[model samples]
Target chain A: MRPLFVSGLCIASALGAGLEESFAALRNGTSGLRPNDFEPFPHPTWIGRVDGLESAPVTGALARFDCRNNRLAQLALAQDGFEQAVARARERHGAARIAVLLGTTTSGILETELAYRRSAETERLLAARDYAATHGMFSLAEFVRARLGLEGPAATVSNACASSAKVFAQAARLIEAGICDAAVVGGVDSLCLTTLYGFRSLELLSAEPCRPCDERRDGLSIGEAGGFALLEKAPGAKAAAALLGYGESSDGYHMSSPHPGGAGALLAMSDALARAGVRPGEVDYVNLHGTGTPANDRAEDAAVHALFGAATPASSTKGWTGHTLGAAGIVEAAISVLCLERGFLPGTLNTGRPDPALRSRVVLESEQRPLSRVLSNSFGFGGNNCSLLFGRAG
Target chain B: MMRVFLHGVGVVGPGLENWAACREVVSGRAPWGEAALRVPVPAMLPLTERRRCNAASRLALAAAEDAIGAGDWPAVGLATVFASADGDGAVTHALCQSFAAREPEVSPTQFHNSVHNAPAGYWGIATRSARPSTSLAADQDSFAAGLFEAALQATLEPGPVLLVAFDLPLPHPLALMRPRRHGLAVALLLGREPRGGALAALALRLEPEAMASPLPPALEALGDNPTARALPLLALLARGEQGEVRLGAVGARQLVARCEQ
Candidate 1:
């Protein structure tokens, strides 16, 4: 597979907006999980909620697309001059030649949830909501493409946590097949009641900041984030990293639970390596999905151990940004890019003691190290798994 | 332009039981009639798993099963692309209603079924396939977007690709927001190379300012559903004729699909 350069990228998460903020937070070992303050139905769990979405609704011509999720996307797109980069790409490849593929589990369902609440409270007819622009799964892509003035093919992937990670793979395919000369690939997942109580319903919410791979790790700290990257067939002079490969697979076991043996996770990792023609030893780091759930962490640990054997330095950055669900893939991929450019390796935050039973060398602190290739994992509900490999552009 | 061989097809919609049963109507050889969409359990699903699947999942699985079965292809290794306009309408309605009623006790099963890829996940379990699968949405253009994605994948990969598009009506109250007149699911087994039993060879190209052909009045009611956007292409195939129809719009361009037999 030909490597697609990450010419432009930006991220907004609990860490903050833009690459600089997130980079500062990550380097300073800041944790973004805060006590549940979200209204309507605030469960007793910490979350990586993005600030300012409430005061900042998408306005103007695209006002109908306004929603917490779309707001996050808007906020992220505004950062790091990503829109400007896209404008340049639009000039390089006609707007219709750049596809937009995004991922999100719950697109603006919060708008629907709020509508339902308001309708019940007022005892009136449910006000008509712009379902397509607001709550539809395609809303994210539609909003982004419209906002960025891109006219190329656009679609939204919604396979749970693996959603965003899979977008990179699709972008690669579309570009490789010449359907699009370039692609804007990423994901945006905002804090919403659906995931809050939904995770609660599954009893997978952690009361504290999620401590991934910790011996006493309980469950995940839900987070909200949005990030994007411009993928081009060739790297620009200033390009810092390239997408070496991406692999996707399904765990045929259970909808919520991962394969106990991490069969699918291993396959995704192996496939990414095989596609990039990179040996396991060549990967400088592994970013585990590491949701902090006992089962999720253990399964990932097993898979990492099976493949890289305790040698590769790996950690979960969830402590700084919780589990961003559908956005996890791109957010982490952005983090990997930062790691490549800054010559640093981020360690698992919020974990004091790594689980002794886990075989992988789970790093506990951020360290400055020159890194080349990195593999990031994002597994989603319904047993969807994706692993992405990024490296310094040659 | 990108090309893929369509080896098999499956469809379920109002009054249409399966591809074989409705070819005459789709081909305009017979008048279409309205009937309830009866989503059958895919034979591949286990009893316990059947009970766990929601309507949308069952609809997609049923169509996928039909397509795989018709092609006589082993389901274990084929990559898949599942697309829908609205995913799991029932679950969304339930969750929203539960929260609105202040009874926010979301059933765990419903929570798991809420994911857009629930159908793909269930299909993987039923077929025990670990092959790559994606679930996507493009609003009213979901079918077209799906077809493009699947064809591109089939062209790039070595094996056959299964494309499934499905959608069901949103329950009342929520239905007021976005209403669908019917439920529909369509599947196509696409391959890079023409197979012995190939139904047709499709050449998909994106064209600017292209207008999608309107559905025949006989099949017009099915048009209310996004997945039914595949009807035009299916209708062309049903006639066993070489023809072209616009699948739907992606962005600024519409996907024009030309079929060669």
Candidate 2:
């Protein structure tokens, strides 16, 4: 099968908007995480939050459906010549021929939750408009589709952290099946009390910026981000990056923790390579699903070592991005594509001393290297693991 | 494009616990269960593993077990796609409450259960199958979407594909959104028809006819007891309902079921 090239790609993350801003932060090894600033939180926890959301402006139609999450998406979509790319796609394929697939865990549910709490009548916690927009997981996708004026298939993938990464797979299948000629695949998630408290309850939230693959790594710092890519079927098209292949697997070993042996992780990596028809040696770098949790880091480390050997350069951008949860997949995938486009691998910040167990297999700091193919990993809570492979467009 | 066939199915929801029970309920021989019970998949995993599975995962496993028992498990490059309207709501709610209490402690078990694909992952582990699996969600049309994804997967990787759709009612305040009893439905599809069984070709058609009742009874029934919809269709097949049956949503999005004798 020919590669599905990413003709245009953009990211709006905590580090800042646009390719230059985000890449500059990665190159400088700056962490986007900071003390929690979102009001309503009872206690302080580190977060990767995008500033100036409350003051962000929206038009009449977009305003009616606007919320913090969609606002984050709007900002990201406006960066890196993204709007121009959409306009070009509209001219090339017609608006109805393009599809929109977004991945998110909580789609405006935070706003709905707040509304319910403030409702005078418990029976009707949500107003009709709010209920229509925020009651379901499809709200985020609906908002984007309407905003972009996309008439083709518009859907949401909510498989936890792997949500956005799998959006690529869905979009690819849609194109391969001749359903759509082009697709916008990405994810958007915002920092909300619900996610912050939820992870805190699970003891998975760190008080400090997460140090992935480090010895003293405590837990993950939840963050918010939105990333998008324009995938076209023109195999010969000039492109920034090409999606080589993707592999997905479920360990079903546990609900929250990964299999100790990393069996499922291994399956996902191997499947992705097999689909790409590339050997492990061909992979130049791996973007790991390193959440900094004790269980997660260990399992991911084991899988990486077993698959690519210890010599393959690998790093977790989560140190800078603060584990964007559902948005992690697409965000990291976008970063991986950027690596192929820019030829510099982002370092795993905050790893002063690497975990002894990971020292042999992990890349603790950033390094520059010529990269042809990069494998990005996104593993979610339910042992749902996905590995997406990207290569420089030929 | 390869033709995908729906060979075998199993469902556990509301008043129906098995294929026979589903047939009875769909044929009006039984009333829907006021409350839902988690049905364990037969021999899909060890008893110990089964004990740890969540309600959605258990229902999916049970349905996959029935589907696989009826047909051979696709050995090479099979893909698993699981869908639900509300994914692990109880576990998500628990996670939220734990955060609200500032407990700084969460059950690793519950945290894992919160994933949408937990059931598909568990099935792969138990089967020791390394094929790629996906967990998907699309609100009330989850079943139709699952079927579409399964068909798409079959087209991409031509093998037997397993699709499971299940959702349980939320606890309290969350339940007010669309309160209903618990339900689950499972269907197994193959690129080619299995040795013995009826075959069905699934297609999607956008019709001009708007539903007289914007919300169709079939849609409501399926939403409340998704597994029950499969039983009625199967019972119709058992009773010789031929040709195609069209189930549509308000916007003319319809799933066309073509059953062959």
Candidate 3:
């Protein structure tokens, strides 16, 4: 697999609103999680809510698409000169030659939830909300494309947690197939009632900030985040890192639960290594999809142990951002690129010690080390799994 | 442009059942008529799994099952791309209604079933396939997006690829918002190499300022469903004719598919 350089990237997570701020937070161990403060129906769980969304509503020509999710997306797009990077890519490869692919689970369903409540109050038919533009699963992609002023082929992957991560794979194939020369791939999932109360019903929410891989780990701390990467055929000589390879697979077991044995997780990791032509030993760091759930951490530990053994330096950055759901893939991908660029390896945050039962060597503290390659894993509901390998672009 | 061979097809729409059963009707040989859309329960799934399916998943899996059965390759190893314009509308409506009513004890089953890839997940379990599968949405252009993704995968990899595009009318109130009039699903088995039962060779390109081919008069009523955007391409395949048709829009560009038998 030929590497596609990530010439430009931007991220807005619980940690901060751009690459620099988020990276600084990661370096300084500044957690962005707070007790449930989301208003009107606050569930008793920690959340990684982005700041200023209420005041930063989507405005201007795209105001009709206003919602928490798109606001998060707009915030990310405003950071790190991502919009400028996209503008450059558009000039280099025409608007129609750059595809827009994004991932999100609930998207603007938050608007729908609010709309439903309003309708119940009014006792009228569900009022028309620009359903397609605001609440549709493709709304994130549509908003991003229109915001970026690109006219390329576009689509939105909604495969749960694996949603945004899979967009990278889609962009790679589209470029390889000559469907597009470049692509703006990213994901955005904001705080929504569907996920909040939904996860609570599943008993998958941790009362404290998520402690990934901790022996006492209970469940995930849901977070809102958005991130994007510009992928192109040529390795931007000055680019910090490139997408070396990606692997995708399904559990074929259960929809809600991961395969207890981590069967699909192991397969996706192995495939990523094989495609990148990198040996397991070459993966200097591993980004675990440690959502802090006992089953998830344990299952992922088994898979990582089988592949990288007990020696690889691995950690779950979820402690920093909570589980960003559909945005997890790109958020972690951006973190992986940061690892390659800054020579830093982030340890699992919020966890004091690795689980006694877990076998993988869980790094408990952030460290500085030159790294050439890293693998990030994102597994979602419906048994969807994706592993992306990034390497320093020489 | 990207090229792929259409190896098999499965379709379910108003007045249509499966691809094998409706090919003649689509080809203009048999008289077309409207009937209530009945999405068969996915028997391919085990009982436990079947019970978990919603209308969207059932419609997608039924079409996928037929396409996989008709294709040359086994279902186990083929990659899949599932597209839905509106995913699990019924579930979304239910979840929102529960919250709206302040009865926030959302059903665990409904939460899991709410993911857009629920059908792909159910498909994986039914076929017991570990092959990579993706679920995407492109508003009304979902079918074209799924086809483009599938064709690209088939061209890049060895095995056949399955593309499933499906959508059902949103339950009212919500339906009052989006207004999809019918339920429809279409699946295509695409392979890089021509198979013995190949329907046609398709070349896909993205063009600006193009419109999707108008549905035949007989199939016009089905066009209200977003997934029915596949009807034009299917109609061409049904007649065993060589021609070009626009699949649908991708942002400001349109996907133009040229079919040759």
Which model scores highest in lDDT? 1
- Stretches off by above 4 angstroms in model 3 are A119-126, A235-237
List the pairs of residues colliding in candidate 2.
A250-B121, A252-B121, A252-B122, A255-B112, A255-B113, A256-B112, B15-B33, B41-B62
lDDT by candidate, in order shown: 0.90, 0.73, 0.89
**Candidate 2: lDDT of B214?**
27
Against the true structure, candidate 3 has what lDDT?
0.89
DockQ of each: 0.75, 0.36, 0.76
Interface RMSD for candidate number 1? 1.5
Model 3 chain B TM at 0.96
Q: Residues A1-394, candidate 1, lDDT per residue (tens digit)?
A: 9999999999999999999999999999999899988865556799898999999989999999988999999999999989999999898888999999999999998877877777644224344578799889999999999999999889999999999999999999989988788999999998888899899999899988999999999999999999999999964437899999988898888889999999999999999998999999999999889999999999999999999998999999999999999999999999999999999999899999999999999999899999999999999888889999999997
Ranking by lDDT: 1, 3, 2
- Candidate 1, residues B124-147, lDDT tens digits: the string is 888778888999999999999999
Candidate 3 clashing pairs?
Answer: none
Candidate 1, clashing residue pairs?
Answer: none
State which candidate, 2 or 3, has the greater TM-score: 3
Q: After superposition, how far is residue B133 of candidate 2 from its true place, in Å?
A: 2.3
Output the worst ten-in-a-row residue range by lDDT, candidate 2 chain B.
B210-219
